[model samples]
Target chain A: MDDPEYRAGIIDLLGALAVGELTAFQRLAADAELAPTRADQAALAGMAVAEFHHFEQIRDRLTELGVALDDAMTPFHEPYVAFHANTAPSNWLEGLVKAYVGDQIATDFYREIAATVDDDTRALVNDVLAEAGHADFVVDRVRAAIDEDPSVAGRLALWGRRLVGEALAQAQRVAADRDALTAIIVGAPGRPGMDLAELGQVLSRLTENHAQRMAKLGLSS
Target chain B: MDDPEYRAGIIDLLGALAVGELTAFQRLAADAELAPTRADQAALAGMAVAEFHHFEQIRDRLTELGVALDDAMTPFHEPYVAFHANTAPSNWLEGLVKAYVGDQIATDFYREIAATVDDDTRALVNDVLAEAGHADFVVDRVRAAIDEDPSVAGRLALWGRRLVGEALAQAQRVAADRDALTAIIVGAPGRPGMDLAELGQVLSRLTENHAQRMAKLGLSS
Candidate 1:
């Protein structure tokens, strides 16, 4: 039973997710200049396209749960928008790390939260997370860039750290601003969602993938 | 014969076209937000994806002509970037009009310039301009928006005008900077390319379609 408290948390998270996708779409598209060839540009465009697919899942789930998409999303826009405006990547490798580290973390959070919802919402979130594709493209691009210039490693690693710190800061804002949602997610298991332990496990998995990816790109995580 | 002047105009124009496709790709992905439903948003995304196809064509031509795609495009980035940076649409409808009106006029210019090239380049340009596969989608969306809210008509009409005017201003700059290429087009009949008069008529036809489309959307000159 999604009482107002829990519903608010889900809405808070979903709102953040929607805005994140919107911002990512803008970044990926703008970042097409980082691409070396027309084919590479199209590949980034494909990744940008995938973000919309994720957006559809989150937006539809919100609509079905009786939250107006815009209204639910309106509150979370400012902080997240400010975060992106400040941290806009200045180069190709920076952009790739932003996409790779940031999206994989967001996906982890969404998956953790999804396990706490009802069957329907779980299905929708699961479906969206299932399409979790394209990080490989980011990894490939970063690895190529790093291969060409080993010096890019240090800069990109630092950029990745900055993005994660900002993401966690804002994510905390999202979780704290809506206690009901946070409580529901934190107190899941028999109630309806994944408990905190399960959530951590999922996060661990996401982080491992990120670490491995960075190492593949010749960067120390 | 193929010379720097001939290439200067054509190259400037081609570079501008590549930028347009790149920008269009980014904008369509961003504009997917303007759609009301998942299907519509996905449709908008599909529309944006097609720009990459045209983008690849232009890049290939640039490569064949021994021009570095980025180098050919370097000079105009600030001006064109300033143009889009200033005119970003806040909603779905504005985004649609931009795609519809802005792209339509661009297609007109592409068609005209394609004709001014040699049979080979003209053939390639024709392939690029061939009916602008997204025109129908833009028209449908514009009409639907107007149908939903007639008030949208007046504003969109003005917006359409502004898009065209801004584009024309940029077009003049592209032309002035690439006079040699312009000469090739305007002087192609006697050179290795096609006829300029034929290009003028082709441009007229494209413009006719644009006007008809505007009227269909309840927009006007």
Candidate 2:
């Protein structure tokens, strides 16, 4: 794990994630207009603010690890950008659900990955992930909105599926190409030996969480 | 000055301003997307968040003062809404300037009004105005952007003037109509007014601040 190759890979993955936070903040801030009320706008804007705060911590951690931000983030630039480009949510509720479910899965994935790292990275991960409070707030609002309007149930559930799917696909692509960092997740040198048992465990947990979340909205996932 | 009518008018004016913050946060949050860069978007988002926080305290104070939020804020709402309808910033830099300079003027006006009140109302206004840190941050970004792009100079400066003019017109309307709040500012009923004379003082201070601000940006009023 201390090897140069492993460290390099770790830096790249984190940089991509950091930049992703930056972009999410920008996108959500823009999407806040779709919110029907000032209260709703505040909720989304809170999430957007949290994203940049997350980015700040992650960027600081990258610097602490002696990673050249530009270089560490370079390998990830295109794919991460494309993912957001293709999946930009068009309306208020869609954007809220996107922030909610998308961030839930990402947080789950990050939690899993953090366990695989050494002390420094683990602490940094913990710090950056403190941003989930706003994510939770958004989820409640989205669920409440769906509750107020039953027809929104089907569409948002479907939207949640697409968000999780796109995230999974992009995550897979990152895994395939960034083996150095991917190795850290499975605590193995290669994908062949890497343990996805941990991921399976998380997927089951996330599915349960998602199901409960849907039920909270009086909807079937 | 201690009359019920005067107190009601003061509450009316503040209520309108409070709702204005609420609406501005919503619009600005959505307008954040107009920013061309990640940093710019983050700055706008931060400003939007602060706007929400600003009004929340004022709302809470109104509640403490035995004023129903809806009733207290009812009078100034439509006029302020019309002001926003009449003038909305068209681009990113213009938006930032609108938030920074425009909000600063509003805050200054609020501070002046607060001075005319007794202890609690004054304390509430002072605290509410303190949350403008993010607006200051956004203004710096707008100024830096203008400095970097001389070609943007003329357009932004012109935009800045129009923003101020629209804002000033709204101020005049608020002052002229809210005679009760004006009584609070003028001190005792028959006394010479604080706001009318102080309006000049406030404008002069704003002019000085703007001069320094423009000088820093290498621009002229």
Candidate 3:
């Protein structure tokens, strides 16, 4: 807590997460427009609302820490915007897969990072990562779509792969730009951080979880 | 409560309100993109989420009464879609005014109808009508924009009028299509309903409030 570098790292982490949630809200709400039925639209809108609530929580936390909400969020804005622009879904099913696979991968990454943060920050991260209870809705719709037209599965599976690839690209860009954030993950003087082996394990775990999520959607990773 | 016609009217009212909230969520969320700043975007997104929450409440009420949620909402869908399509804001300021003026008008109409419903329905209607606390945000922004560029006011004022006009046109269409909803307002035998004079008063009040809202936003109605 006394370390200036650690405090800076925590701020960067919170900022990144806050912006992530905000963009997720925007993207999901936009995707809801592509929904085939009003019921599906409502479901996607519910998820968007949940993301906005999570964004509010992180915003409040940032405010409590004496950080300007906009200042904390601005640095990560480009990365998130670029990611969404590059991976914008062409249709509703692609949007569903992006919401499902993309969000879970981010959640898994944040959960891992949460392990390395202070108790208070860890709790906040975990709390926000808690699913909005719509995974089954996404899974159900995606699976039913595939069942009805097995041919679409190939294109969707490729979309899933593209989502993860773009997410990682944006994340790496953020990590490269924010040394304080990477320091928190990889270690600084007098700080506990993941060693190379442990970092490999984290990446492995993230990949494994991504594959499982793809499978859950009845798509190959 | 035992009058089948009255029951049908109540369902129609709730259904109309539910679909209204649902579309409001979609419209607000869509309009959030036109926001010029991240703060503005978040503000609009917050309002959208609030509308969705209200939608959920009306939805549950409809379900508890054993009405199918989709069926209750379907009849009003076309009118809502048409209203939004016709009045879609041209830019961020237009979007804000539409949100503030347009939503207030809808709220005012529902409140008037609320006065004629059963106590339970009245409570729910009032509960959802309670503002999401962002009126001040919209008021401040629209007023600020007008102050910065006085020329925009005439255009915005015209936009506000168009919104109200489009809203009235859709309301009439809904009334014509849903006899039960109209019967609730105009009254059926053995049921209390608004007399023509009372209906005129309701319209006057709606208009007055709309003007007040427009004035608050530095626009004319």
Question: TM-score per candidate, in order?
Answer: 0.68, 0.78, 0.96
| Residue A51 lDDT in candidate 2 | 79
Best by DockQ: 3
- Please provide, for model 3 over A1-221, each residue's C-alpha lDDT reduced to its tens digit, 9 standing for 90 to 100: 67888999999999999889989998998898898877788898888889999999998999899998778888998999999999999999999999989889999999999899999999999999998899999999999999999998999989988998999999999989999999989998888799999999999999999999999989998
What lDDT tens digits, residue by residue, belong to model 1 across residues A79-189? 677778767888766777877777777777777777667676677666766655676777777887778888888988888778777877887876777666677677644
Ranked candidates, highest lDDT first: 3, 1, 2
> lDDT at B110 for candidate 2?
74
Worst 10-residue stretch by lDDT in candidate 3 chain B?
A: B183-192
User: Which regions in candidate 3 have their CA more than 4 angstroms from the true location?
Assistant: none
Docking class of 1: incorrect
Q: By summed lDDT, which 10 consecutive residues of candidate 2 chain B come out lowest?
A: B186-195
- lDDT agreement with native, every candidate: 0.72, 0.70, 0.91
> In model 1, where do residues sit more than 4 Å from their true spots?
A1-15, A34-40, A60-67, A131-133, A147-149, A188-207, B1-19, B27-97, B109-162, B165-200, B206-220
The alpha-carbon lDDT assigned to residue B81 of candidate 1 equals: 67
Which residues of candidate 2, in runs, are more than 4 Å off? Answer: A66-92, A130-149, A176-179, A186-193, A196-198, B1-3, B13-52, B63-96, B131-149, B172-192, B195-198
By TM-score, who's the top model here? 3
Task: Order the candidates by DockQ, highest first.
Answer: 3, 2, 1
Prediction 3 TM-score vs. true: 0.96
**Residue pairs with clashing backbones, model 2:** none
The true-versus-predicted C-alpha distance at residue B175 of model 3, in Å, is 1.1
How large is the i-RMS for each model, in angstroms? 5.2, 4.4, 1.4
